[model samples]
Target: MNKDYFKLTGEKINIEDLSREIVSDSKDEEIKKELYDELVPKLRELHAKLFAEAKYGILVVLQAIDAAGKDEIIKYIFSNLTPQGLKNTSFGKPTEEEESHDYLWRINKGLPKRGEIAILNRSYYEDIISPKIYDTLDSLPDEIKNDPELWNKRYKQLNNFEEYLDENGFKVVKFYFHVSKDEQRKRLLERIEDSTKNHEFSFSDLEDRDNWDKYQKAFEEMLNNTSTEIAPWYVLPADNPWYSRKVATLALIDVIKKINPKFPEFSAEDKEKAEKIAEQLKNKEI
Candidate 1:
């Protein structure tokens, strides 16, 4: 009911700042639970409207550090949306085939179709991170990789691709699940300690952990470069899984509300035809 809901207001919401509001300790369970209770219904209503007014499909991009609760956020925040109108896709380690193509090619294959909501778990940002961390591009000949001009060209290409999507009527909403390093280590250790959660851990995650600082720098640059009026990023505080889901829900619905798409209109002729059919039924003589 708040008219000002989801208005970014150019306010800088640091993850550390918002985490202070979350009742991480035992005393705040009631406050946390109440927020969840209130947030879910608002999300459900927004989803229903979005589903009906499905002219413009919404693409939600979720990016986060490992053990940042990306899966849990998806499971909780979108639990109420009908499967018929929603599509969820997760990108794993790139295949040999994917590695051979332009980075956006694989991601472009996952864009939402008309009249649907598409959620991308991790997106094209790997171009920035993968190259920076692995130095894979450095292996290329100096004719290509060594040129600052070539890298600038790729960044421009990425920006143009996103702009093209917007011009074609896709509503893009990107969220970065902002988890602190301390929380990340705690989560990874929990996976090690809990047999049930062990299945979620991958050996490759350690390799990623080795480059944690590099990835953080990668992410900051990616956010800075790709953050645009059309596809802005929301850096969600994800230390508390509950709060993460709540903020994701709030952020998504807020974007949907801003789009304010209306259902397709029927022509007057279509209404007249409907009325004639109703009149025949009333007469009951045919």
Candidate 2:
């Protein structure tokens, strides 16, 4: 695996220069199904070790444009894992109560506990990007919104936030589903044409389409400013959902491998105690 293939090697990224589809020999579905079939099991194994060790947790933040298959691919990747300590949270538009607090406050609800794995479909990330696109920051102070350095400050705050999470034992991994403008147009149209998919379409989606460039610029700035060694970003080419899933699988496993959790070891006395209890149960001696 190329250690930095999915990472930002430089301080600046021109979103226009990025490829929206991976170069692959196999079919789109085969890319994910075959390449990821092996790694999904490895992900589960690592997840089990993570839970058993109960000393660390991981936060996977899925950031994408509309119709980029963030939800679809997440289900495909983690579908088979036991739900015991797994958490999936989608943070949509803020409620009135959420709007009353600091931008990162609502994130507390989506955070994972030690021994748990959490997927934040959208996260405190929205506070940085969405408001930039819509040009609204009612949740924030009037003074800050008018400042020229508001976004840069927010980016620094986000870096500090993730750094805090890392210090407290939660590893942060971010995935940006990089879909091209043409592919987004096609998918948005498909949502309108397919009767089964009509529910996914809305005029608001088109509203976002109008500001696509603004959103791209916001994404580029966020990635450049906030991507750090402790919490790196993986840019997944999302025009082909399957291909993106395949790449995401590799990146996911790579991060978990680095985390390298192991099941806890027992002391001799604890092991003997457990063995005796097991033997008593086996012999039907209550």
Candidate 3:
């Protein structure tokens, strides 16, 4: 895999300059599907190893604008993982109880346990972007609402939080699906035109459409501020869902490989006892 192709760890990224359409180097649809078919079983094997090792935890945070295929990607990539080892969470508007605590409180509650995988459909970064774009932070205390340094401060806090996770054996992998306005419009229209998909369209999504540029700026700044070595972001071209899923799968597999989880070895005495038990069972003896 070309490590530099989709990763945005230390690089400066401008959303305007990045193409939402698949790059020439991206595998075509058929090839992407074939690769994904081949990768899923390997991913499941790795996940099983990760579960048995009982050491490290993996957190996959996915962020995107409306109609960016976040759900589809999650479904496709995680379908083969052992259900007991995986948990999926999606964050929409915060509840009244959530608003009473610190922004990362709910996020902390959703973290994966050791040897498990947690997939967050949207995460604490929403506090940094959506509230800023929608002016939802105006109700907060003046220190946070009025301070020009608030975003920078939040970025520092986020980096510190991720560093803490890294030190404690949790790996954070973040992805920002970069869907073009034209593609977004197309998807939204599909939702409107198809009766079956009508349930997927939300009135608030229409309200967000008017703030498209504001949201883009917010996303760019968020990515620039928080894309770190420990919790790096991958900016995926989301126009072609197949290509994006393929890239995401490869990235995930690479990270799992780096973590290099393995099944725990038994002590010599335990191994001998297990062999004796196996022989007894094979002979249908007590």
Candidate 4:
């Protein structure tokens, strides 16, 4: 199935192409209204099937730059997934306890059990992408102090982790929300200028913004290294929130569609037993 939201490695999609197809301008309010109307119900139906199947779990990892609408996309796509069948985790800097352990320890603890869908807001890619780009190497052991091959080794480790998950019946779908720097600047400014959104702004966000070029280079490298047949990364367009949500929802639904587990078929003996029970209840008053 051609599940790409926007092609990153090949000919990339234009902002206007995504905007026209995914979301019209806020001036055209009808697009958002219509898209959401169609979105929620269809997602709910997929959730019901995904929940009932009970054989496999889906791990959805969303990685995005600041103001790329990751939070908004999560809220919309998972609105209908039952709480029992779903779990959402947002990763941040390691706590003291988390810091004491290996990098994978915190992330492995967040994995979903069978028949559940776990949404990782930002995932272990931070271990590979963030530390390398930001020079957060103070925590690394002395053995790997300045090794040039450290990144390649980490990528191999990630591939092994994903391979293990796939063998154990977990489907990992990772998304990289690709927003242009200009678009990110616009959204950040919107938060800065509006009093209501001021609370969402952080000093660290600005620091990250300053290293925008470095982060993009890191992201490009990370995606190229980690994009495997077992666990593919979908580079999603994040310039339009409405369209992003729709695309995410559809991508998830498509994955769930592959696991087509119907309610079990009844045998002749089972049918006979049910018939006997039904005949006994026929005399009861409605």
**Highest TM-score against the true fold, candidate:** 3
lDDT of each: 0.71, 0.83, 0.87, 0.75
Model 2 clashes, total count? 0
Better-scoring candidate (lDDT), 3 or 4:
3
Q: Write the per-residue lDDT of candidate 4 for residues 170-196, one digit (tens) a residue.
A: 888888887877888888898899999
lDDT, candidate 1, 180-263, per-residue tens:
788888888999999999998887888888888888777766666666777777666566666556666777777777877565
Taking all chains together, the TM-score of candidate 1 against the true structure is: 0.82
* Better TM-score candidate (1, 4): 4
What is the TM-score of each predicted model, taking all chains together? 0.82, 0.93, 0.95, 0.84
Cα lDDT tens digits, model 3, 1-286, are 4756788886887889986876554557675666566877778889999999989999999998899999988777786788889989999888988888888989976799988889999999999988877777755899778999989999999999988998999999998999988889999999999999999898788778889999899999988999988999988889978778877877888889999999999799999999999999999997
Q: Residue 198 of model 1: what lDDT? A: 96
Report how far residue 223 has shifted in candidate 2, in Å: 1.1
* Candidate 1 displacement at residue 202 in angstroms: 0.6
Candidate 4 lands at a TM-score of: 0.84
Candidate 4 Cα RMSD after full superposition onto the native fold (Å): 3.9
Badly placed stretches (over 4 Å) of model 4 are 5-34, 263-286
* 10 residues in a row with least lDDT, candidate 3: 23-32
Off by over 4 Å in 2: 1-3, 24-26
Q: How far is candidate 2 from the true structure (C-alpha RMSD, Å)?
A: 1.8
